[model samples]
Each structure stands twice: as C-alpha cells, then as structure tokens.
Target: MESLRNLPLLDQLKDQSISTLVQTSLIALIGVLLLVKLVQRLRLNLPPGPLPLPIVGNWLQFKEGLNPRNLAELANKYGDVCMLQMGQRKVLVISSPEMAKEVLQTQGVEFGSRARNLVFDMTTGKGSDMVFADYGEHWRKMRRIATIPFFTNKVVQQSRRGWEEEVDLALNDIKEMPGSTTSGVMVNFRLQLMMYNIVYRMMFSRKFSGLHDPLYVKLMTLNLENNRLAQSFKYNYGDYVPSLKPFLKGYLKEVWETNQRRLSFLRDEFLNERKRQTGEKIGVDFFLEAAAKGEISETNVLYLIQNMNVAAIETTLWSSEWGIAELINNPQIQDKIRNELDRVLGKGVPVTEPDIANLPYLQAMVKEILRMHMVIPMLVPHMNLQATKLGKYDIPAGCRVLVNAWGIANNPKYWEKPEVFNPDRFLKEKIEPTGNDFRFIPFGSGRRSCPGSLIALPILGIVLGRIMQRFELLPPPGVDKVDLRSVGGQLSLVLASKPRVVLKPRQI
Candidate 1:
C-alpha cells in the first residue's frame, strides 16, 4: 500500500478494478473540461459581465433577478452592454442607446433571431411560433397575414370604434356606480382594460360577459405568485446542467394546453354561430380567416390564438398600466396632459376619432411612455443568415443577436435623463423613430417589428385619452409620488407595480 505510487501506472492498473475505474474517470474528466471550454467559447464577446457559474448562471447576480433597479445598477458597473449567462443561453443585455439602435435598426437583419428556448419548442413546435420564429419565409408569411388584415392602417381605422367603444365602456363602468366611483369595485384596472382592448378584440371580437366564462375569469385575475414563479423557472439553466430542462417545463406548456382547450371551446361556439347565420362563410375575424373550414390544423389554430392573446393582451395592458402609474406619480405631467386633452377635446364630450389628430401632447405621452417603459424591451433575437461584422465583433453566420431595446430606450447618448420619465423630449425637433434612430422603441423595429403597432396607437391613444379625460387619478392620502416603484415578470416588457389607487370621477 505504501509503495503503490512507485509501482507505476501499468502495475497499479493491472489490478483490473483500478484500471477500469481510472480509464472511466479520466475520460469523464476530459469530457467535462472540453464541454466547459465549449460553453465558455459559446458565450461570445464576454462584454464584461458579473461572474456566472454552473446551472444558475448570472441569475444569482440579482437577489430579485433582473428588476429595473438591478439593470440600472448593472449598467453603472459593467458599462451599457453586458452578457448575462442565463442557464445554457448567453443573455446579452445592452443598457445603452447607440448599441441598441445599431442592433435594432442598422444591423437589424443580422441581429433578428429569437431565443429558441424549450418553452418555445414545446409550445409552437420546431420554432413555428411567430414571436420566436426564425427571421425567414415562415415568420414573414405569418407576420404578413396578421398585419394585412388585422393591423394595417385600414384595419386600425376599422378598429377605431372598437377601441373607442371599449374606452367608452371603461369610462361608463367607472361612472356607472350610483353610490361611489371608487367604492366596493375591487377590480384590477390594468388587467380589465387589457382584456377588453387586447385579448377580447383579438380573439372573439368582443368583451367578456360573465363569471361563467372560466378561461376569461382565470386570465383576468392576477396570479402574482405563479407569474413570478413561471418567470424565475425559465431563467434557471446553464451549460453545466444541459439536460435539466424537462424537470421544469410546466408553465408554458400548461398555458399553451389551456389555450388549446379554450380554442376548442371557441371552435364549437363558432360552428354553432355558423348554423345560425343564413348562408355565408366564416366572418372577418382573426380565427375565421386562419382556420375557416379548419384549413389550418386545430393545434395551429390553438397556438395562434394563444399567441395572439398573450402578445396583444400584455403589450397594450402593460403600457397603459405603467403610463398611468407614471402620470399618477408625476402629477405635473398629469396636469399638463389633462390641460392638453381639455384644449383638444374639451369637457362634456366623449373623445372622437377625429379628435385624436389634435392631441399631440397625448401622443407625446404615449411615445414617452413607450421609450421609458419598453413593452418587449429586447426585440426577438435576430438570427444572421450569413456572416457580417457589427462594431468591433466579427459575428459569424447563425449567431443569435439580441436587439437591446431596453438599452436603446434608455441610452444616455440619445436620451438625456433617460431614467427620469419625461414626454417633452419626444416633442423636441423630430423624434419619429423610423428604424434609423432607435432612441424610443416600445413595439420593436424593422420588418419584424410588431405588426400591431398601427393597431395599437389608436387603441392606446383612445384609452389613455378617455381615461385621462374622465378620472382624477390621485395618490393615496399621504403617500409620496416620488417613491413609486414598478415591478413585473423578469425579462418581460410587462410592468405591474404600484399599489392600486381610488379613482374619483372629476368634472371635465
């Protein structure tokens, strides 16, 4: 035993057990080292990020995980562009404006690829999902179909009434209460409005009617705990634990399946409605057009419907929520906006489609809100078809590019006081972001920028205009507006923060 080392490699291994064990152990160690180096190389352009190790990656960097404050703090330390290693993926984060502009605008095609996560695969199959689809024919086709019919300028003109009516209902809902405007209502304004404008219009072409509708009811109620949990679960992965995804693939799958069931229910309803119609093909709604006579498979229809719901639902809703919160916190901005609306529309009159044209201040508020608060902060990752150079880095073909809209939205080079919310900055000179200057990006940019952009503007303008026109949004009794904090799903454009406030109808 004492002279075992001196016996040499061959002699020690002659004891069959030792040789077999030694061979296996050596092979495993080599494999692990090679795998690690491969992963290290995969995390390209290091970009000076915090230390990330094993399965967790840089998720541990923030105790709360990528909150607005955490991002702000990271920028202070690691410049603007930082690569955060999340699980097996290199989450490249840019906290600057110029870099963001380059990624989304000039180098858009090069950087236009989506992160092909397990959730995407499980939900949409082979990256067929529009939001996460590759920047090629399929994505283009799907997007074109959506934009041409539902989101084009003409469609937006058509939707003006829907938008107006929804806002009208909201205004009425607030004022309808005989006893009090802010008493015994107990509703989530953000969630409620999103349903009416986004999900309701996008899917069935109407609003939810009653509590008997389980899916709509379930959707409207905020599951803060589950939403946060689902978010935290996805960001928990790394190269060291490459085979660990299956253990935690519940949320997205469950949601997709739930949506599928809902679509089945919708299909049945549509068929029944068809029976009632005298004699005609399916109506001009998103669903009827996509799967009339079930041309598209039920599964695809389900996926499509579900996708539409989340995208439309969250973007419009979150924008309104944060914008309102911003206004509530900055009463001066609120007062200024109210004055502008009054000057444009006047009191004792419901806002009209023609009236929207004159509301520059309202337009500025929405633009500013989008800039300061990005809906989908980072555009879907843009995939490069061929090799090209961006900045100092010589990017290879097929490398995933993250267009950091978050960084661009708050880039100090383009935006002064980027963090502090201000709408006037948009009014200065010419500030229309036409993919050339990405200083303000709420709905992404380029050919792949959200098709719903046109559809959304009028909807947003109408809702925001009507609400601002009707309500006196006030801070709670003694709470300071300066301390307002925002929170929401990690890595999402959705921001749900600030406690609820009582809204009293003020005379216009």
Candidate 2:
C-alpha cells in the first residue's frame, strides 16, 4: 500500500489528468495576475496616461495624427502630461506650460536629444540634416557650422531682400493675372509659386521653374496634399510593424516608395550640382557656401539644400496658408491687420522688412495662428540622452519626450479662452507656460529649436502682409466661412491644399 501510494496508486489515469489540468489552470491564472501587477508597477513611475492594453498602448486614442486635437482633449482630461504610444516607441507628451517649461526650458537637456527612429534616419540618410541628427559631436558640428551660414543675422539680411524680391514677383504675377472680373481669383498660387520660390532661391539661387518638371511637380506634390498623406502613414503598420514593413499590403508602401524614389532623384540632382561646383569658386547657393566653412561636409551641404527646399518651403507655405485661412475666417482679424498695413505701407507698395515693425497686430495674428495650429506640434519628438529627473519624476535614459506645443499654446490654463483666435494672448501679461514663460514664440526654444525661425516668421509676415496689401482677400462666391480642415497622415498640421481665394486687384 505504501509503495502504491508513492507510485501514484497505480495511476488513477483520468483523475491524474484532471489534477494536472487543475494545476495548469491555476498557474496560468496566477501568472496573469502577476503580469498585471508587474506591469502596473513598472508604469507607476511614468507620467499619467489612458489605460493601455498589452501590445497596443494609447495608440488607439490618437492615430498617427498630423494635428492631434485628440491629444489636446486628453490633456484636458488626463492632466497636462500624457503618454502616447507608437508601437515600441514611447512618447511622453507635455501639454501644459508647467510641463512644457520643465521639458523645454529648465530641464531641456534631459529632454533635448533627438529621436533615433529608423524612418527618420532613413529619410535623412540616417539624419544627415542638422534638424534630425542625434546629439553628439557630429550633431554639434552640423548645428554650429550649417546654422552659421544659413541662420546668421547676415544670412537673415541677405535672404530678406531675396524674399522681398520674390514676393514682388508674386505680386507682379498677381497684378498681371488676366481676368475679366478684375478681382483676382482665390487660388493657391503661393503653393505653385511664391513660397517655393523663396526657399528655392535661397537654396539653388533661382526661382523654382518647370511646373511639369519632376522637381517642380515633386515640390508641387510636397504641398498640402502630401502633408495629409504622410500623416496617414505614420500611424499605419509600415512605420511600425517590422515584418509587415518589407511586405506592406497597403497604399502606404507604394506611396513611400514613390516618394523615396523622388527623394533619391532629387538628392542626386542636388549632389550633382555640388559635385559640379567642386573646385569652382563656391557660388552663392547655400549648399556651396556652407560647405566652404570646412566643418559642414558635402553630404551635409546636400542635406541642407534638400532640407532648405523641403523644410523651408513646406513649413513657411503651410503656415502662411493657415494665416490666410484665419484671416478669411476672422475678417475682423484681417480688417485689423489690413488697417495696420494700410497705415504703414499706404497703397500700391509690396510689404517689406521695413513694413513689418509697424504691423504688431499682424505679428500677433501670425503668432496666434501658430499657437492654435502648431504646424509641427510636439516640435519633432526630442530625445533623452543622460538619465535625469524632471521635477519629481525620474526620466530614464533614452526616453523620448514630446513637448506638446499644440496644447501648451492653446490650453485654457495657459492662454485665455484657448479655443478662440485671439492674438492678444501673446501681446502682454505673464501667463503660466504651456512650457517656458517667454512671449509666445512658436518656433521653439533652446539649442535644438528650429534654426530657421528668424527666417520663417518674416517670410510669413511678408507673404501674408503683401497679399493683404496688394489684393483684397475674400472667400470666393458660394464659399463661406473659409472652412478648412487638415487632410490626415502628415507629421505636420498644414491645411489641406485646397485653393482658397481672396479677391485680388479689382475688388479692393
């Protein structure tokens, strides 16, 4: 009997199997409980966020959005600091000025590193552009050298006249536009012409021509249409699912491939231009001029040229469009701005740098538009290099941080009546930072903030101002309210590139 007992009593086979099943079930239940506890414990120290399911965190909340009004809404609910999920990438979004100040200002270095994602790296030839490069000696060199020629006050002065000159051309084109009504049609000519010309002239030393040319078409395609498309793909699998990326099943892969091909072709053209200028007296093109500075490499020069085209053109154009849309929507804003312009420039003169100082209301309008629609909100997902503490929280090494400039700029906590389009918020009064407590500078702050702000704003102010000065902007017949919404899937929040008209020439 003792031997049988030790030997499982000659094996009551069915009963033994039942016992095993019970044990297995109990183990699985305990394991699940332990996993839940473990996960909760691990995430406890992280910032507040919506409850996350395994494998997919808060990704379902905000799709790979160009403009995440959803995220801002979450800030209203979950407090200013929220955590977003993009596959394995962890995004920490700071939606209030307090958090923004902590991340963007007092604790900038802790959150100052740039993202090391595969797509961004591949797009930038592994971040050859100064804007996207990782923080290190090479990045420093890129920032110091490339920024010198491109962003210097001297460069600002040089480009200012060029911007005015090209704007004058756009004005001339608008004036000469043949039409029976005499009022200029509300068209996105700025998309095809002026905005592209400003960046093109600065980069390649001539106005961008050849509408049917692949370069022109590529630049043309890069406008509002592309902004929506790109934003769509960011939240899709091609950007995240490793296995699915190679064998993509959606339009995203095709779109990416086509654009990648265009980028390659454009890069070759840019490089060939540089190669041709190898020993020649390094001409006026920004790429060549920067390469002459010794620290900035030829590859970096090409990168700068490409970025100057893509970066300067896209952001400036889209932002100007928003200012236009805002002006159209808020005629009072436009009327006030136009009154200032009329006072400063009188009639029949295109807006130049001289006219900018006198137009504070216009400046405020631009700032307000930037605040409401932070074109590249989150300001390109800064990274963490060294381990540091953000207030009481311990921000681990290699953590990626996003300063939610969109919410910070528009939070009622930071701005009075965050929803309404009021430029006066930026005018005076010290308010809590949606991040840093400086006057509402939409360009960003610190060493890694956009090196192009000084250039970008004036381009916006001038383009918008001149458009108002030269032509009277009114919504086209049957088009009321200037209702414009973004087409999704871009990484930036630019208006969907539909043509909106302001009655030019005759109507005013």
Pick by lDDT: which candidate is best? 2
- Give me the displacement of residue 168 in model 1, in angstroms: 1.4
After superposition, which runs of candidate 1 have C-alpha atoms over 4 Å from their true positions? 1-87, 177-194, 197-203, 210-215, 218-230, 238-240, 249-298, 384-388, 396-400, 493-498
Worst 10-residue lDDT window for candidate 1 reads: 178-187
lDDT of 2 by residue, 1-508 (tens): 6786766654677688899999999888767855974575486576666765444445555555424577777777777676655544566776766666677777766676687454455456677777778767777877766566567767777778988888777666655555412433544564447777776666555466534566666655643343445445553555543554655445545455654664665567655655565432322344555567766667676566556665667677778778778777777776777778777777666678766777788777777778777778667778887767766565656766766677666666656788888877656753321224633446677666777776777888888887777666677666677766765333577676554564555344
- The clash tally of candidate 1 reads 10
C-alpha local distance difference test of each model: 0.61, 0.65
lDDT of candidate 1 at residue 137, scale 0 to 100: 73
Could you tell me every candidate's TM-score relative to the true structure? Answer: 0.79, 0.82
**What does each candidate score in C-alpha RMSD?**
5.3, 5.7
The model with the greatest TM-score is: 2
Candidate 1, residue 225: the lDDT equals 30
Model 1: per-residue Cα lDDT over 106-221, one tens digit each: 77776776655444455456566567677777676566545555666666666567667666766676555443343323234634654554445544555565434665555544
